[model samples]
Target: MTDPNQSVLSKLPNNVIDEILIRLPFRDAVCTSILSKEWRKHWCRLPQLTLDSDFWKSKKDLTGDKRATSNFTMTIHNIITRHSGPLTKFTLCIQYWEIYPPIDNLLYFLSRNRIQHLVLKLPRQFKLPPSFFTCLHLRHLFLQNCLLLPPPDFKGFDRLIRLELHEVTISSKLLESLISNCLLLEQLVLRISDTLSDIIEINAPMLKSCDFTGDMTTICLKCVPRLTELSLRYYRKDWKEFDVANFLTSNFFESCPDHLEHLHLDYGVIAKGQEIPKKLPFDLLCVKHLCMCIYLDRDEILCPLSLIRSFPFLQYLEIQMEHNFKKNMPALECLEMEAFPDVIFEHLREVTLIEANASIREMQLIKLLLAMSPALVKMVISPHRFLGKSTIVKTLTKLAEFECAPKAEIFLKLV
Candidate 1:
């Protein structure tokens, strides 16, 4: 019997075979060299290489080799040296804890080859080589647990589009300088960096998406004229409190770009005595999609409602609910009376309630939104856990009885 797989693969063009090999892990793709002489020739031409730490660890476990770091370093050096084509993408993740692998040589080779996409996640903070910053052809760069110290005369990444830094130690001034230099940069993400304690300021005019998740006293969006999506997850540390309302009210958001559309705010963890902002500082009239992940406590609930009133153009709303069922729902009538008269979500078409148990308070809020949003089209209620069929039916019946929009549809989803 003839093997159809081999027959089909044999008929494939060399370029198609190279494409397939490029998508596979470096180790697996290299192993295909044993399949045939043609495959061996095609594999060497692959432009993408992903060297994951887990693969090296598994190899070490199988071979019982204590010098895994040395082996990994040598393997990567040999692979880079033997490659026949221009390297476009390279990812290296080192997991050996005993010693820091020599990455300067690898980065130098990649830089010389004009790599376009680069990702490095080292076990410890490895100082980046100056050659890395000079990779003019690089477009996407993601570094985790690395030290970045750009030279004083650092001419920025001219063609870089997306830059992500996680647990990287870079000063606010240096980061701003680096971003200011990237003329064509589009998206920027900073996540949980221990060194970022100062007031962070972003001034990218061409940027479209910005996301920050960490502890910062203040964040100022200096001038992101083209920003359409913004996500912020503030983590409170010690007794120092950060106020979201103040940030929104600042000149930064007050005169925020009109192009902004998507906004996501998550209050990850608040201190015992800390207080969540009661009201948004400025109206999000231009925003169309809004997501709020907050505790369903007295102060937190009012903020979302206030935000709903502020963003009159909001088309989609997603709320992640968190609260104690043992405690009674707070008096929301006062808030409703104060905010509901000004709130008419005429453009809101979809509402999503996540981690909901269909409790009385949640039902009330849903009903309130349904009544307010005259153009509501769909309401998706995703419960925290599965419920009995009878319970689901009852819940649906209750929802159907609510005075919703003329064409509103309700769906009960169990998770």
Candidate 2:
């Protein structure tokens, strides 16, 4: 029997249906419009527009030409014009095929609508449409592989909150202008070419999270008071040698709190093994939550243990070890332990270890847990890829048997 609620639910307004469809992939939602007359016109008015080549086909049945790129562009323009509302999002992804025409007209249309989120992925070079400078409401922007011909000016998006660039090239002046103009930006990610200096000029006063990825490493922070979270991944060398001291020497976190509540740094160091940086003068006295993904060889220095102890108020810690360390690696006994067991926090609550290779090598962690003054509320242990279930269970049983505080629980998974 059909439920009475089903009929009521079906009576809901078409606008609500359009809202739901906007969140789905552009191709799938657009095709649903053909199923019913009521659905056909609503899709054209969706605030979010996503165009991807994967949904298009070359066939005599659908269109005379399989590669009708012009038709696709025209269809997109019609959708925007019919929608008659400020667009919230516009994403265009073009992959593999190179038959596409210039996208300047599309960008201009999107900019004119003052889209809040925009993502464009293209293969070749293209100039930013003149209308791009007027997109003042844009909050999130992502551009990949679209080589900016003259390197468009950054003054375009004044309210951009988040920006991501991958495999793109930009001049330092443009980069500086972009950062300076997005004064309210909270998160920023940069992955670019090596020729471009690994530099970031952050003038955002309300900036909070920052991630600098790739081999390129130089970064300069000018005036960011509210900034807290920072992530540095795949750097060429230690970022400590940079002018962090100069940036903070006058006053560390003066505009923000004395302590950062969370920090993530996945970077390479000068040491051969998983060694911690030599007792650096810089201090993160207020960090409370930390997630670290660091790469270290079997015999490298063990820096994570010491690093955690430095955070006086640390309550939660998550560590993801590199996968390469688990294969044909040397014994853990061969490494140093001076900094290992002493790093457990006095107020620590949860500790999670991802991709741990050897159970024997994990004894150092067990020793650290046993030495903790505070009750470690929860612990997660994930064994290496090759570790057997029986071995992991036995190892966990042994570790769990060790003396622990009143509120401690251990979790283990073998992968």
Model 2's C-alpha root-mean-square deviation from the true structure amounts to 5.2
- Model 2 lDDT, residue 33, Cα: 69
Candidate 1 collision pairs:
none
Work out the TM-score per prediction. Answer: 0.88, 0.80
List ranges where model 1 is wrong by over 4 Å.
1-11, 57-66, 95-98, 193-195, 236-240, 269-281, 297-299, 324-339, 386-394
Report the lDDT tens digits of candidate 2 across residue range 1-415: 7556555545769777877887777778877766555567666777888876545545421332344566666766776567676678988776444554556666677778878898877554544555556667889988877555332354446688898877666676677777787877888888754455646656777788877775423455677677777766554323432232233233323333553577775644333432344323355677777888634453433555444555667788888867464444444552334444444467888888888764445655555555573667888877777777787767767886677667887778645
Give one digit per residue, the lDDT tens place, for model 1 in 3-62. Answer: 677667678897888778877777788888777555666666778888775456575533
Root-mean-square deviation (CA) per prediction: 3.3, 5.2
lDDT scores in order: 0.75, 0.64
User: Pick by lDDT: which candidate is best?
Assistant: 1
Cα lDDT for residue 78, candidate 2 = 71
Give the Å shift of residue 255 in candidate 2: 9.8
